[model samples]
Target: MAEDLAREEPRFPPAEADVLVPLVPARREGGAHRVRFGLAYLALAAVAGAALGTTVVVLDRPGKTAGPEWSSWQPSGDRDAHPRQIADHVSQRYRRPSGTQLVAVTYAGEPQVQQVPLSAVAIQTGGDGSDSPPKFVQIENGLMYNLCGLGPSCAFPEGELSEGGLQLLRREALELALYSFKYAGADSVIALLPPNVGNQQDPDDDTSRTLFFQKRDLARELERPLRTTLLAPEQPQPAEIDPDEGLIIDRLTQPRLFQYEIRQAQEGSAFLILAPLVGG
Candidate 1:
């Protein structure tokens, strides 16, 4: 039986030879194509990642973008100069329309005399002494009897001034504060206008009407031509004033006044005492 089976030809169902295809050849071809596609995808991803990394590096660089408008006024002269020196520079350069110099009072109560009686006190904040860079600058100026029309010879009565006159006085004080902010790198400015004539006589007098200004608030004006911003109107009228300008004027004209005292606990240890003036 073994010999008969070996000699007999295998009889099975007949099929077309063309229809019998090997799976290995098809699989090998598909796998090769998939590997090529994967390599191309990885190459593209690498390029995209490089581009994004470059963008981030460019953006991270300093001064690549513009700063705020108010920051355009860069500090000039000796970069390492003391704050007091900077204050002195600002005072010397400042000029009024009448071509008169502004009086500058230092922290130690020493006065730098000028042609005009108008005074400016630059108070440095957040520092051990005048040598350090100030965090903020407080500029105090007086509205003298002559300026306020309060003297016997003036048209206005004592302690009285027209709305226009008051606004003019505030504008002068604000301009000085702006100069300090621009030249001294002050972040904020406190423009203190003490009661008309009394505080002028006494340097330590606490009675004051204050107008606060942040660098951001006057950014637009500072960006414009300095002459235009400082231009004195022939006759300033309330009706013709811009709304933004009006807001600042309104704040200056507020009834309330701020009072503060300077007390020195010991030599080289000075402090301030602040409170709202009652019925001011």
Candidate 2:
């Protein structure tokens, strides 16, 4: 009976059918998933690259620049040797851009200049101690007044008049005073020889004590004082004069020594006052 049933059914064991699993469909699904993951990773990489590129572009631009530079220039030739020529040069160049100029002067190695408008005046004065009191004066932006005085005659041990006294006075004056120029008008300036008096000594005594006066400080004392009533106002009531004119200017033009007088005897004392030269 078993043989007959086996022949009629042509049957295999159920275990063989179970053994034929759907391997191809599972492999296809796994491959599809892997492809999707790869594409996602590529998209993420592209996004990161784009973000980095944007960051790099924003960090490149421009900023601030520099300022104006002044070239080293000497005055019209050596006209600096003469105060009057310097004044004229300053007058001619006395404007900026449309109408201002810068005038500079140097003593030893220190240099000073001013920015003045047209019509301002620049002045420079020089003399022996005999013409003006030896003094040092400086103004912020206006006129400077100066005085020079000559040395007194002196007798040497030989009972003869010695030129050494004059020479000493000249040296003292040269060391004591300075020529200063300041703006006097919109287009002009005035030169000044400031007094540098060290003291009032007897003409006969070579060893007398000298009293010194700093012209610049004295001018300031006249304008503004410290602690004491040493300064006296100008007399003759110059008629409620606008102090500004005497104390102000567009700017201060430094003094230049055009010519120097070694020993003229008329002891001179020049006083300088600076005032604004603009605004009515």
Candidate 3:
């Protein structure tokens, strides 16, 4: 029976084989058992490779990086952060102390950026009873005057301006003088005479004295303009004195002195590339 089986199975000759193997078991299941696990593993590997390829394709799509615009662009620094930048521009034009205070302006709500150029800012002085001349001054219209105290002795009659009166006026005038100007030119100075008092000099003629603010000959030596105001015990004769703003030429014979303060908003400065203001 073994020889018959061997003959039917076609066994290899012993001289030709180190170990005789049978093909019967392999052929019994049509080779399915031999390759079943390998085929399953190959299918799994193909599925995994397809998933990885899909992920790579999705990541390589266009229009993927659209970040915020501001992420790359930064805002400027605070407008007031660099006061010296403005001061340096002013210093080039005017003789000034290093201690000059700079008033910076910016967008109302924003503190980190300048709304205007450094030259556009103006400086105002404080009337602290001191004779230090104001740093920033303006010549708008024709007159150059500051506000007066609302007291009874606000006006000074012409006759009462004696040597003592002149002394007092001079003290006040020092405060109002514009020593260091940023926006005005030396030639822009003008004189404004006090208003004539009702054209009468009668007894009890309680009228405000005529005061004048004269421009100095800055070409010779820079002189501060005269600053005058009246201090009386009663209401002003006109009831209210409007601020005079225009150029007026008159004598400052009995010049009076007054103190004044300069504020930033009240003044303006500019780094003008000044050509002729108008065309030919």
Task: Give lDDT per model, in order.
Answer: 0.43, 0.29, 0.28
Please list all clashing residue pairs in model 1, or write none if there are none.
Answer: none
Tell how far residue 30 is off in model 2, in angstroms: 1.9
> Which digits, one per residue and each the tens of the lDDT, describe model 3 over residues 1-280?
3342221222333566575677666574757765885787677777767766666566655866864331111223553322222223322321112322111111122111133222211222343354554343333322232222222343334443333323222222222222212122212222111222222344354423322232452222222222222222211112122223111111122222221111233244331111110100
Model 2, 1-280: lDDT tens per residue? 3342222222333544446655566777778988997997787777767765655555443456643322122234342343433344323432222232211222221111232211221222233333443433332233211222222221122222223222222222222222222111111122322222211233333331111223443344233322122111221112222344223211111122222222212333222222211111
User: Number of the top candidate by lDDT?
Assistant: 1
TM-scores vs. true structure, each candidate: 0.35, 0.24, 0.21
Stretches of model 1 off by over 4 angstroms after superposition: 1-160, 188-190, 197-206, 210-240, 251-257, 266-268, 277-280
RMSD of each: 18.8, 25.6, 26.3
- Candidate scoring better on TM-score of 1 and 3: 1
Best by TM-score: 1
- Please give the lDDT score at residue 115 for candidate 1: 31
* RMSD after Cα superposition, model 3: 26.3
Give the runs in model 3 whose Cα sits over 4 Å from its true position: 1-143, 147-150, 156-163, 178-203, 214-218, 223-280
